[model samples]
Target: MEYFELNDGNKMPAVGFGTYKLTDPEETPNTVDAAISAGYRLIDTARVYTNEALVGKGIKQNGIPRDQLFVTSKVWISDNGYDKTKQAIDSSLEKLQLDYLDLYLIHQPYGDNYGSWRAMEEAQAAGKIKSLGVSNFPDYQITDLAQFNKVKPAINQIEINPWNQEKATVDYLKSYGIQPEAWAPFAQGYDHIFTNPTLSQIAESHGKGVGQVMLRWLFQRGIVSIAKSAKPARIKENVDVFDFNLSDDEMKQISELDRKEGVSADHTDPKTVLRLSKYTTNLNGLD
Candidate 1:
């Protein structure tokens, strides 16, 4: 698998296995184990996912040396502020059962992020985390954030897929020397992208499945993409993307399939933000 060079001069795998919408604790451990055994070195999870301990267990069971694996987790808004963030980092460690995190992200742009960033900076300095970043943060938020912090974010995990390329946002992130990563890359299989005439033609030409074509497209664009699945066979299949390459024509045509403004939720709407914030709370242990 290819890796993206971070601003701090470290290389991160361009493709990772994500655990989103996966709340079953029992399923998480085995799913993670299957992915690691199948050659996935990058595993992305978050406190909100409520499966960090299971992810850690899977890694330990695989007996893969800690250095060989890249584990990422996010701090929730409820854990914002300096002291709170510091506490949250330690809590994440307990959940993941790790000595240090490869990457720790501030889960959202809300709450006392200024304090949160400061705490993240401290965590890096103390070697509790190798790198730090944010998820779901827009350009303005990043701009507002940089004014106080000494460390720039290493990566920004956002929504990027064939339908919602968000080139403008991608360009803005690049300008800050921050790598843009994709979360819901397949749009949760919501659209006809799987069988679109253009995508199908591209897939046929390359002798790859439509999923492979989409993955290849994201990788060719230099974005770190986290694709998730509970099925073991599918877990292995998702990472077998290094063998194929998307052509310039195919890439360009696919890039044009952009649906300019399509975040998974209406991030601009206060109601949407309020609704998502609810996930930050205890979630009644249901999540």
Candidate 2:
């Protein structure tokens, strides 16, 4: 697996396993173990996912050295504040059964993000979190946060897929020196992404699947990506993207397929802010 060096000088795995909806107590751990067995060292979860304990169990089951694995979790919207975020950090460490997290992020841009960032900074200074970042934050929001905060954000994870290329945002992020991480790299197979003609043609040319092509495209752009899957075969397939390379023309063809839209919620919408703020979870309990 390849690694990306963050602004803080921490090396993060380029392709990470995303546990967004992998909530089954019995199944999540096994899948996570399988992913680890398939050479995935980066595992991303969130307090909102309500499966940190299970993910923790999987980490133990794999028996890999703690330092060799990169575990990440997030502070949910409800936990956004200096006090709540500090507590949330400890709660996550307890649930994940880890001494410290390799990375911790603000799940959303809403709430008292400044307060949350301050808490994150403290956690890093205290050695509870190795690196701090934000998710679903636009370029402007990230810029403001980075400029004012003592510690610049190491990463900004946002939607980037064939339909939502986010070219301008990505360019700005790179220029600003914040590593761009891609969430929903496959768009959750939206709009029949796996069967799209352009992607299929590109896959055929490279003797790879559309998923691999997409991941390779992101890799070529120097973007870290998170891919989620419950099936072991799919989990193994997602990480097998380092074998091939996409040419400049193929990359351009894929770029042409961008629609500048995403399948996920709009972070800028007021309704989104309202909904996420009210979406509370019991981090102490597993789902």
> Alpha carbon lDDT of residue 43, candidate 2?
98
Instruction: Kindly report which residue stretches of model 1 are placed more than 4 angstroms away from their true locations once superposed.
Output: 284-287
Summarize candidate 2's per-residue lDDT along 119-177 as a digit string, tens digits: 99999999999999999998889999999999999999899998999999999999998
The lDDT per prediction is 0.84, 0.92
- Candidate 1: tens digits of C-alpha lDDT, residues 172-217: 8888899999988887786677788898999899887777788888
Highest-lDDT candidate: 2
Candidate 2 contains a number of clashing pairs equal to: 0
Candidate 1 local distance difference test against the native: 0.84
Please list all clashing residue pairs in model 1, or write none if there are none.
Answer: none
Worst 10 residues of 2 by lDDT: 278-287
> What value does the lDDT take at residue 47 in candidate 1?
79
